[model samples]
Target: MRILVTGASGWIGSASVTELIAAGHQVVGLVRSDAGAAKVAALGAEFLHGSLEDLPALHAAAREVDGVVHLGYVHDFSRMDDAARIDRAAIETFGDALAGRGGPLLIASGTLGLARGRVGSELDQPDPAVHPRVANAAHALALAQRGVRSIVVRFAPTVHGAGGDHGFVAMLAHIARQRGVSGYLGDGANRWPAVHRLDCAALVRLAIERAAPGAVLHAVAEEGVATRDIAHAIGDALGLQTVAVAPEHAAEHFGWLAAFYGADAPASSAVTRESLGWTPRQPTLLADIAAGHYPGD
Candidate 1:
């Protein structure tokens, strides 16, 4: 299959290119800059020049490829609404192009906010009103009815691995370095699910290859790791003290991350593993942290 992968120069997107190419698939990666194009070329993927905001570019790429793996997302938290608008438009363009073609459209989503205080599974539905991206995910799943095999893979918040990861764990490590202490919210009991970068890339490959239409998959390896344990890991790596911040002081201590640091967003991947036979064969979050990939600069 000739796959068009958006965010192909990104962290997980780059890994997915390697995984797909190893499985004998041709990849055309969407890149927004010369640097991104060069990175894609180094990975042996053909490059398509465009940003996610370019609906026409998205449509053209979708029409030209056998499948699409939508992994690109704007990370601007302050402009989430704008990012979501672009994502929805891009998804719609791809759906329109693949409507009657039976082509696979595997999109990246998140396990957070799907359910609160419990382990979220593929069975749970995200409230569209909660976030625009959540609504966009549902829109992609509905494309199944339009003759497209659309699959949504919900990724854990902390997709950890070797260096180059700038996700939650890395953020925490950086904060710890700046503050001289690794802190978690309240008693630090809230949980967060995690998966290695390589494992996530593997799941993306499996979904595009075999997932049924409207299938929702979780790319979680550890269902839940206590936030305190995570803090301890960071503390150990940076030789800093691990402390708990009161809920009232969380914002001051952790900055913008306080909003998510206290969330108990554990997720289950049992169904994904059973359905796709995806066994994660990579280091766990703590192991990866201990290996020093997240040592704060």
Candidate 2:
């Protein structure tokens, strides 16, 4: 199958391209920069220059592919509504183009905010009121009714690996180095699910290939890693002390990333594993940290 991938230049998206190509599928990666284009090209994928907000580009690209794996997202927390509007438009464009077609449309969603104090699963639903962009997943799933095989893959907040990782774990290392200590909020009891990027890419390939219509898959490997444990890992890596930041002082300590670090979004991938036969082979998040993957500066 020939696949069209948005955000093909991104971390997981790039890994997905490699995975799909290795699986004997032709990939057309949608990218916005020469660097992105080169990354996809190096993976032997054809490149189309466009951004997610470009509806016409999305329509044209979707019309030519057997499936789509949408990984592009504008993660501007301050201007979330604007970012959501762009994502909604892009999903709608694909939905329109793929309507009446039986091809798969796999989209990336998050396990964050889906649940608190407990583990989130594929069975849980995200409220659109909390984050407008989350509605894009629902919209994509609805496309299944129009003869499109739409699958939503809700990923853990921390998708960790070595080298080019810029996700939460990397940021925590940077914060630890900058602040001279690794801090966790309120005894650091909260938890966050995590997966290695390669494992996540494999899941993407399986999801686009065999997922049922309107299926919601969890791309998690470790169900939960306590914030305190993560803090200690970072401390060990940077040779810094691990400290517990009081809830009231979390904002000051973590800056804008405080809320995310404090969130308890543990998630399970049992359904995904059983449904797709995806067993993660990559190293765990803490192991990656120990390997000195996320170096501050």
Candidate 3:
């Protein structure tokens, strides 16, 4: 299969391209810059110079590929409307190109707020009100009815790894270092699920290879690692004390990350594992933090 992966220079996209090429598929990564092109080329994939907003380029690339793994998104919380609009346009463009074709269209989503205060599963429908991008996944899923094999891979909030992770976990560490204390919300009981980037990439490869149309999958490894535990791990790594931030001060302390850090979104991949025979062999979140994968190492 010839796969076109958007955001192919990203943390997960780079890994997914490597996984796909290793499995004997040709990969063309949609990149917006020469640096991104070089990065994808270094991973043994061809590059298509484009961004998610470039529908003509995306449609052209989509029309030529056997499948698409849509991972590109403008992740600006301040400009969520713009981000969602761009993502929705890309999904629609891909859907238009692949309608009646039955080729896989895997779009990334998140496990957060899919189920509040409990463990979320593959069957839980995303609430667009909770996050702007959820609506885009819903749109992609509707493409399945038009003969597109649209699969939504809801990634855990924390996709942690060594050296290059700039996601939530890394931001937490940076905040902790700046504050001199690792902090959690309220009583620090909120939980967050996580997965390693490589494990997530492997799952993407498997989904593109074998997952059914309209399938909703969880790219989560640990079901939930409590926020307090996570803070303790960060504190251990950074040699700081773990503290609980009150609701009134959360914004002041964590800035735009407060809402995300305070979510209790645990998710299970049992159905995904049973359906695809996919198992995550990555280190646990706490273990990664203990190993100094989060900075201050």
Candidate No. with top TM-score: 1
Q: Higher TM-score: candidate 1 or 2?
A: 1
Point out where model 2 deviates above 4 Å: none
Which whole-number lDDT from 0 to 100 does residue 287 have in model 2? 96
Write candidate 2's Cα lDDT for 202-245 as tens digits.
99999988999999999899999999999999999889999999
Candidate 3 wrongly placed segments (more than 4 Å) = none
TM-score of 2: 0.98
Model 1: weakest 10-residue lDDT segment is 111-120
Task: Please report how far candidate 3 places residue 175 from its true position, in Å.
Answer: 0.5
lDDT of 1 by residue, 1-297 (tens): 999999999999999999999999999999999999999999999999999988887898899999999999998988989999989999999999999899999998999987876778999987888888999999999999999999999999999989699888889999999999998888888899999999999999999889999999999999999999999999998899999889999889888899999998889999999999999999999999999999877
**Model 1 global lDDT (CA atoms, 0 to 1):** 0.93
lDDT of each: 0.93, 0.91, 0.91
Clash pairs for candidate 3:
none
How far residue 203's Cα lies from its native spot in candidate 2, in Å, is: 0.3
How much is 108 displaced in model 1, in angstroms?
A: 0.8
